[model samples]
Target: MQIEQQAAIVTGGASGLGAATARALAARGAKVAVLDRNADGAAALAREIGADGQAIGIGCDITDTASVLAALDAARAAHGSARLLLNVAGIGTAKRIVGKDGAPAPLEDFERVVRVNLVGTYNVTRLVVAEMVKLAPLADGERGVVVNTASVAAFDGQVGQEAYAASKGGIVGMTLPLARDLAQFGVRVCTIAPGLFLTPLMAELPQAVQESLAASIPFPKRLGKPEEFAQLAAAIIENPALNGEVIRLDGALRLPPR
Candidate 1:
């Protein structure tokens, strides 16, 4: 599970937590593949890592099975079998199931969120696990580690987050079973349910809005940093016994109902 010189695949590597994890992995000497739908951003990040030969950029829409398959194939071609799989690609939106407009939020929107956030994670995880099983195990017989991104909303979703919460809940539910199934293969699975983080998407909000969200935290009263999440991922990959759990990086803050 030592990251050095090993192949790692990071979905949504173009920005946010995904980008941070990819950079961290590369910095730790891992051959990283920046997989994302944002082709330009992914390519730019790969170049910035200064390992164009070892770091690659692959464009993919994780919701589409064919697109994900192609992305995984491209990564395998570039860096051999990937031993680290990071599932960080997802989308979120807020809408009441019933609205003042006299019509409920479109079902398509809910489906889209679930498809990308939940199904997408499963798609990439399945493909990567298959490939990881083919590789020879490392010391301690560990073949690979999968780090998935969930959300604090899974446990404390507000009024308008029905779709988002359900999707994240699915990920949290799968973590332990996945670890149990992959254990014999020396593949560890864990999920990180992050609270508010200073990701690019959140940066778009008004300053006051951002501050309000941060202030809601019981301690620190600030957004979590991407590097903090990356640190946990690094630790999970190295610790053989830390499997089958969803660790919240929420600074002891449980969210309130909105």
Candidate 2:
């Protein structure tokens, strides 16, 4: 799509890959709505890309239906109908189903992870996709595209990552089915499974742990950058033919069993 005339909604837009993607989309002339729990950060990003009135920020909680509906409305108010949807809000934690302290991992914690990473992605996509289906198609009869965030843990989760891995795996598993369901409407769905990236969580690791993680990648020998992720997102937006696939942005890294 010629991005200038396009409108996009990005969840988790307050920071990391989502923030980079919002900037990249704006740079390419797409109007963007930044949806995030961090209102201050989202508002700041919106102001940064005020040119052509292309960006706005909305406070959102992806796991809540009412919050999501309000945020979608806010996006439409700023950018008209959304043609691009990026699902990037998720949480990660490491706990075995059976913990070392003889206490089983709480079901609530597992449910929370699934709620934000799996159900949350589904919530925003379903809401925004309804709008996309209503939009007039591009020259190729394409109405919209969706990019969802998964994690390499889904495939090669280290020990103690049961909840996180399951959540991301669900995200990955939904891609193909969603694509098929949305095909008639020309809305493509894809997922990205990232390895160790230079995101906030990884950055907080001890230097030694971080270094060990970087060394595990087969090539590149470093952490993935948020901009690289944004680059892939831009490509997915531009290429209508790419759909129903989960692409890994892990620098050829298959994690080891912890």
Candidate 3:
């Protein structure tokens, strides 16, 4: 879909990869809604984007039906129904299945991760997709596209990452199934599994730890920039035939188990 003047929804848009994507989408002329749990942060970004009609930021909880619906209502009220949905909201808290003392991890811990990452992605997707099919297809019966964020951990699954990895793996596992389910409506689904990135928090780590992480990447020997992820998302949006695929944006790096 041509991004210019189109409406797009980006969850987790208050910071990290989501923030970068929201900015990139707006730069391309798409009126964007920045959906995030950080109400103040989201509002700040909307102001920064100069609500000159280009963006609106709404506080949203991806796992709650009422919250998400309210967010969508606010976004639609600001822009029109969105034709592009970017599922970037997720949590990455880590915990091992068993503690060093040998006690099993709490089930709620695992469930929370799954609920926020996998189920959250689906919650927003279902609502946005419903609105998408109502839109008149852009030429060739193409109505919309969904871009989901997964993580390289889904494949490598280092120790202490059971909850986080399981959540992401669920996203990778469902890409094709989601695409197939929405095919009849001309809405496509795709996923991106990114490697380590230099987000603000990561940038605050000690230099030695940062260097060690950078050295692990196969090529470029560095953590990824948020803009790089956004660029790939923009490319996927513009390409009509790219669907049901999970592209690894890890610079050819396959992580070793910790």
| Clash totals, every prediction | 0, 0, 0
TM-score of each: 0.98, 0.97, 0.98
Q: Which stretches of candidate 2 lie over 4 Å from their true place?
A: none
Q: Where in model 1 is the C-alpha error above 4 Å?
A: none
lDDT per residue for candidate 1 within 1-258, as digits (tens), equals: 788998999999999999999989999999999999999999999999845587999899998889988988888888898999999999999999999888889999999999999999999999889989888987689999999999999999999999999999999999999999999898999999999999999999999999999999887789999999998888888788889999999989898888
For model 2, how does the per-residue alpha-carbon lDDT over 102-149 read when each residue is reduced to its tens digit? 998899999999999999999989988987898888889989899999
After the best TM-score superposition of candidate 2, give how far the Cα of residue 206 lies from its true spot, in angstroms: 2.2
Model 2 poorest 10 in a row by lDDT: 1-10
Q: Please list all clashing residue pairs in model 3, or write none if there are none.
A: none
Off by over 4 Å in 3: none
lDDT of 3 by residue, 54-153 (tens): 9998999999999999999999998989999999889988778889899999999999999999999999999999999989988879899999999999
In order, candidate lDDTs are 0.92, 0.90, 0.92
